[model samples]
Target: MINLTINGFEVEVEQGATILQAAEKIGIKIPTFCYDDRFKPHGSCRICVVEVEGARSLMTACCIPATDGMIVQTESEAVVEARREILDLILANHPLDCLTCEKAGRCTLQDLCYQYDIEETSYDGARKSYEKDVSNEFYTADQTKCILCGKCVYMCSQVQNTDALCFVDRGFETHVGTPFEQGISESTCVSCGNCVSVCPVGALMPKRREKYRYWEVDKVQTTCSYCGVGCQMELLVKDNKIMEVLPVTGHCNEGLLCVKGRFSFDFVSHSDRLQKPLIRKNGELTEASWDEAYNLITSKIKEIKESDGPDAVAGFSSARGLTEDNYLMTKMMRAAIGTNNVDHCARL
Candidate 1:
């Protein structure tokens, strides 16, 4: 354990823990954009700079390790000014279109700007701009809105291991792009959406625009039912309809998701999906009451057991079904039906 003082409050954290993690442990909110648990701390944003006693200058708290007997000031006047200046520079390049941006309420950069009261930028220069890349069917990339924090680039390479995004060119002209300046749709990207998940601004956003504001939507935590991996996700719901799917951190999948679990959710609300039990009547499939469906299934099972024997009965469970549901189905086939002819799609 290493002991450190942040804002005059003594706190102890595990060895090799960064100052930002130590401060967060004690309920101190340190604003950051380039620091996430899934990736290495790059400290490119310089938004989490803090002052340390005997230090020559301010240090980025996100990557600096906490040492024993270290004294840190998280929000001194100098630290505040430094953070404000960094934000000012970032906003100089970032477009002022938050009012209509898809990431308006949920954007990390917007939240930090509000926290630090950065109403405008002090630096004025030619802003870097690029044509919007909407070729990626799932999301759009507008380089004009990017702050070049490198979170998305790192996420694509380190976390997702896709290496689909990279910084092109040199300082001032540097920007996130694909290899050979091709569209993301033409790259090796599998559309897992991890890059979009880590973007701090509206630079990357889903193609399907959400209808409600961030506060208006209710985030319901649930496990992804697409596979056996059991990746957790947050369903952004508005008016009983799912607006978006967000990856949940620190779960079985560790805040990562495949393309299917992240983007193949529209089927839930598809018009062709069955909402009730259907049974064939008069040579056509028609909706049936729950009781009627259960009665018909029970009668058929009894007839098959009596005439063809229990060994003839078989059941197949879907991988999309919950674990408990599949377990119950297996138990019913073996214990109640007196047959072992049961299997799940996931096993196949």
Candidate 2:
């Protein structure tokens, strides 16, 4: 264990813990622009710079490991000034279109600027004029809004294992995109949108129907129904409509979702979606109440069981249903119905 004093609070953390981790253990909030818990910290943003008791200069809290008897000040006067300057430099080139950008409510850069009381950039520097990459079907890449944090690049390459994006050019001209600065559609990009989830700014925005503010939606946790993997996810709903699908870190997917799991949730609110139980009468399917449908199903199943035995009434549970529901279906078939003709659609 290593003992460190972060913002005057003495804390102990396991060996190899970073200064940022130590500060967090002591309830000190050190803002970071390029830190994502899913990957290793590279400390490229320098926004989490902090003052150590005897260090030569400010050290990035995200990357610098905490040492025994270390005294760290995460929000000291010098550290705050350095962070403010870092935000100023980032804002100088970043586009000031938060109101129009869909990422406005959740943008980390915007929050930092507000925290440091920077209403606008003081530097009138040259901003990148790269056109938006609308080639990808799932999301768009606006380089002008990018801060070159490399979070998307790291997520795509390290987590998704697709090296579709890389740093192109150098210095002020640098931006992350498909290899050789090619369009996302023309490269090895899979449109998984994992990179989009990791992005801290409006540079990578998901393409969706209508815009939504963060506070306008109520998050509802549910499992992805695209497959039987049972990946945990959250449904961002507004006015009884699904606004977005965000992956939740749980037993199955661990905060990562595939292209279908992330972007194929529109069907939930489609007009063609079936809401009521349907009964086939005279070869025509008609909507029926739940009680009526249950009565018809019970009579038909009992008739078939009496005429040709319980084996005649086979039950095929769907994979889309919950695991517990499927288990109950199997139990009813073997115990109550006295048949072994129960199976799952996944087998077929």
Candidate 3:
């Protein structure tokens, strides 16, 4: 264990731990942009700069290894000024359309700027120009709002193991793009939207949410119904209508979701959803009230029991239903209907 002082608090951490990790252990928050816990520290964005005693200059806490007896000041004036200046530089090139951006309220860049009290840009010049790439059916990439932090690139390549995005060109003219400058729709991109999830700014956003604002919907936390992965997500409901889906943090998904879990929620609003129960009457289907449907179902079960025994009555449950519903269905089948043939289509 290596002992270090961060924000005047002495703490013991594993040897070779970065200052960012150590500070995090002691509850000292160092704002970061390009640092993901699952990825190797890139240190491209210097927002996590901190002052180390006896060092010539401020070092990036994300990549700087903590040595024994090292004293780190994370909130000194010099450190705060350095972080503020770095954020200002990032904001200088960032787009000023946060009000309309889908990531406006949840953006890390906007949160960092608010933390450091940065309200206006100091540098004034012609901003970089780039067209919005909406070729991908799942997401949209706006180069003008990109900060070149490489979080999307790292997430796409390292996390998802799909190298759909890469840095193109060199220096200030460099930007992220698909191979051959092709749109993501024409590439082998899996459309997982991990890049969109980790993007610090509004550079990458879901394409379905282009016409909506951040505050225009109500977000409800719920478990995903796609696969057995059970990833958690926020269902964005606008006036009782699902507008979009957003992934929740600190859950089983770890803020990452697959393509189906991210975009395949239209079944909730599908036109075929059974709003009312239907029964065949005189060889024609007719919508029935809940009471009538239940009574008919009960009479059929009684008839089947009297004619073909209890084995003829079968009940099927849905795996997508909640735990309480599953338990109740099992209870109703075994106790109320006296049937052991209860099963679910999901099992098949």
Candidate 4:
């Protein structure tokens, strides 16, 4: 373990730990934009700059290793000024459309601006603008709102192991896009929406949610029921109806999801969902009350057991059911019906 001083407080950390990691361990926050725990650190933003004693210039805390007996000042006046200037440079070329952006309330850039009390853009520079690319059915990309932090690029190419996005040009004209400048729908993109989840600003957003602002909806955190992957997702509800789905970080899925788990949740409230039991009468199907359906099933099961023995009855389970429900189904099949032939299609 290496001992260091962060913000005048003694902290012990691993030998190869970064200054940002040590500060985070000691409850000292260093603002950052391009650093994600799940991805390799790219110190391109320069917002986590900190002053190290005996150093000639401020170093990026995210990339600088914490050495023993090193003294780091996270929030000195010079450090704060440098961070504000870096943030100003980022905001100079960024679009000023936060009110209607999908990442409005949850945007990291907006939070950092508020933290530094930056009321306006200090530099009057020409803002770069790009046409909104909505070619993909699942998501849209607006390069004007992009901070060039490479979060989406790292998430798609490195973390998810899907090289669906990459830097396409050189220098100031560089921007993230698919190969051959093809639309995401025309490329090998799988529409997992991991890039959308990691975007710090409004560059990447869900296509279905473009009509409404983020603050106009309610977010409900719930476990995904699609597969046994057991990923955590947020159901964006509006007016008692589901609007979209967003994956949560550090969960079972690591903020990544398949197409089925991300977009197939509309079946939850589909009109074809069975709300009540159905019975066949006079060669036609008719809706029946719960009590009537229960009685009919019970009578049929009793008749089968009495005539053909308990082995004549069987029950099937579904994988979509909760764990407790599956457990109860197995218990009832073995204990009540005394039938070992009972099984579930989910077992296949």
Of the candidates numbered 1 and 3, which has the greater TM-score value?
Answer: 1
lDDT score, candidate 2: 0.88
Best by lDDT: 1
lDDT of each residue in 88-143, candidate 4, tens digit only: 88888887777666687779999999999886788996777788889988789998
What's the C-alpha lDDT at position 327 in model 1? 87
Alpha-carbon lDDT of model 3: 0.86
lDDT accuracy of residue 8 in candidate 2: 77
**Model 3: how far is 82 from its true place, Å?**
1.5
Q: What is the TM-score of each predicted model, taking all chains together?
A: 0.96, 0.93, 0.83, 0.87
**What C-alpha lDDT values do all the predictions have?**
0.89, 0.88, 0.86, 0.85
lDDT ranking, best first: 1, 2, 3, 4
Give one digit per residue, the lDDT tens place, for model 1 in 1-348.
989899999999999999999999999988888899788998998999999999999999999999999999999999999988888888888888878878889998888889889988888789888999999878899999988889999999998898999999998899999999888989999999998988888898887745677888999999998976678999998888888889997558888888887777888888989999999999998999999999999999999999999998999999887788888998999999999999888677
- The candidate scoring highest on TM-score is 1
Which portions of model 4 show Cα errors greater than 4 Å? 209-212, 216-218, 281-284, 288-295, 309-314, 327-348
Residue 129, candidate 3: how far off, in angstroms?
1.9
Greater-lDDT candidate between 1 and 2: 1
- Every model's Cα RMSD, please? 1.5, 1.9, 3.4, 2.7
